[model samples]
Target: MPSETARELRRRLHQQQLISAFGREALRGAGLDGLLQDAARAASEGLDTDLAKVLQHLPGEQCLLIVAGVGWGPDVIGVVRFGTDLASPAGFALRTGAPVISNHLGGEGRFRTPQLMVEHGVRRAVNVLIRGEAGAPPFGVLEVDSRDAQEEFSESDVAFLQSLANVVGLAIDRDRDRRDRDLLTREAHHRVKNSLQIAQTLLRLQLREVEDPEAKRQLEQAARRIMTIGAVHERLFSGPAIGLVVVATYLRGLVEDLRASLGVGDGGRPLALEVTPASEEAVWDGDRVTTLGLVATELVTNAFKYGRGTVTLRFEIAALTGGGTLVVADEGDGPPPGFDQAKGGLGMRILTTLLRGGGLAAERPPEGGFRFVATLAPPPAGNGG
Candidate 1:
């Protein structure tokens, strides 16, 4: 037989494995319900207990809700709730960031349902508070019960269970963070899309008043640019990731819209816009998309007006000698030599302002086609595509 120390080490290793698995499973779970279920199961296995119950602190209700329970009857777990104002041991433990250990539940002064505890044969119990991080409120509580009244919990047992509670707290915080981020992202996208739609409507109405064909054409081009911005926002609202719009997908949709808007039917051979990323995917923030959309509008609009052959738009992140460069290229005749940035009128001025606002430098490609290159900073970490 193995020595006591060897058996203890083996048990701790098993517990560590359980904690790691629990953390992963908890994160993958859909919502708070899934998290509660995972926590209960993990707690039971990690603490070697027959019964485990998870109680989330619902401050609005002024009570601890029994979210999940394992190895317990409906009478014992279902009807048990601790009020915030009540002086129960469990509540006290949670409020004070301490642990409550009762070898005999019937004799415990703070248990509200001593007779129920006796009826259910819950002889001993322990409740630990799952406190949140520094400066945050408590997340919840973990309650473990055993039928054996004589079984006394060791200090090591308490420490191990406390570690499990810490993991639970971390999981809860992460889920909350993810939810808040998603909400903010959705709101931002919704507002931007609404604003762009309004701008498109205004531009379309203004186009009707302009008698000059050239002026009407310019107005229409500006409207199309606004529509492209709206398209980016639409993708952001529909996609799963917050604050991230896929460059290739956004470009493809924009090109298709441009083809339809320009009245290039199936037989007419629509302008082809293709984006090949340097990486598998390129994710841009709202500000970046706004700047890039304007640049794309200028290039694609010029292509439609002047280019004879097919028009293709490609985007790639390049490793510049100094830093990274975002290149937007199209298969069209290059801009006129010495193209005046300031004298090219409102469109060029808007493009210049947007690029400068995003802390980027834009220039045309040296080869035959029109290409706009902008140097951009890396996006924030964890803003996944």
Candidate 2:
């Protein structure tokens, strides 16, 4: 048989592995609540203790919040708070970035135990400071103990608990990063929404001063185009994707809005629009989606204004370059051949830029009316990717 010292070393190594595995599993969740519970579970099981608490430091309040716990009353999990006095063992351990142990609270004098701990019969326990990244402050504390009065914690047990605390600390860092990114994204969405509203208001204001009916109609179209792009940002903010956008869903909603905007076309006839997709989703970043959205608005609007019968939108994916293609086609007569080069404005410029390297293509298929088929540039896969 192996010596006692060798067995102790083996035990410590096994506990380290267990802590690492559970730490990662705990961090994988939709939000903070799930993550906390996971971390608490990991700590309790790894330490073979009856109780464990994952505490969060509340600097502003100068206290620690028990965010997660195992083997405690349900009411106490998020309800308990501990003062951060340096004189107290738990607080001192947090302040000094060290571990503190109490063999038995019944006869202890150096540190005071909380009223809740005494009620729960927490006889012997160890507290370790859960720390964050190198420059950051501690996340909280991990406390574990056996309920039995006969239990005694050794130095190796304290070290094992401390390792568990460090594992949870890294998870806290990841969660913090996610929260920061989400906050910035929401702020960006709010600013963009305001800017689009202002642009729409300006276009409407200009529309009221036009002398010719045709000019007024053109200005109205411009306002609607801005609204289409605005709709995109709205959808982006609603979904979980941080950096990418699902192009198919965005176009579906945009098509519906386009139909409503141009209710009647030429002689007050009801206008109908349809979209055909490959049933697969495509992801793209902000700039690329913006470009594609603008292109679709121009083509779909042109089709409704000048074409007859039903208007259809077609979408395809190009797996090779990780981008996709969109075709806005109608049965009506197509734009003149020189139409692409003659109009050097913003919308046309987008098309011209894409058409050169075959990233986009526009053509009037000889079979029917007009069609603007654009092969979008290979854009970054957004949050969905």
lDDT of each: 0.69, 0.74
Clashing pairs in 1: none
- Judged by lDDT, which candidate is best? 2
Per-residue CA lDDT of model 1 for 1-385, tens digit only, reads 6698897788778878887887677667557667677777777777677688888888887777677878867764546666654366567667888887777666767665434345668778777888877889897788777788666666666676777788778877888888888888788779988999999999898988899998898889878888987887888754446667666677677778878777776776456655544533666666666666767776666656765556665565533321234454555655577766677767667666765623433355566656555554444455432
Model 1, global lDDT: 0.69
TM per prediction: 0.63, 0.79
Off by over 4 Å in 1: 1-46, 50-53, 57-100, 104-123, 131-139, 147-150, 154-178, 267-269, 275-280, 316-385
Candidate 2: tens digits of C-alpha lDDT, residues 100-195: 888887778877888888888788778888888998988888888667777577788777777777767777787898889989987898789789
Which residue pairs collide, candidate 2?
Answer: 244-382, 244-383, 332-369, 360-375
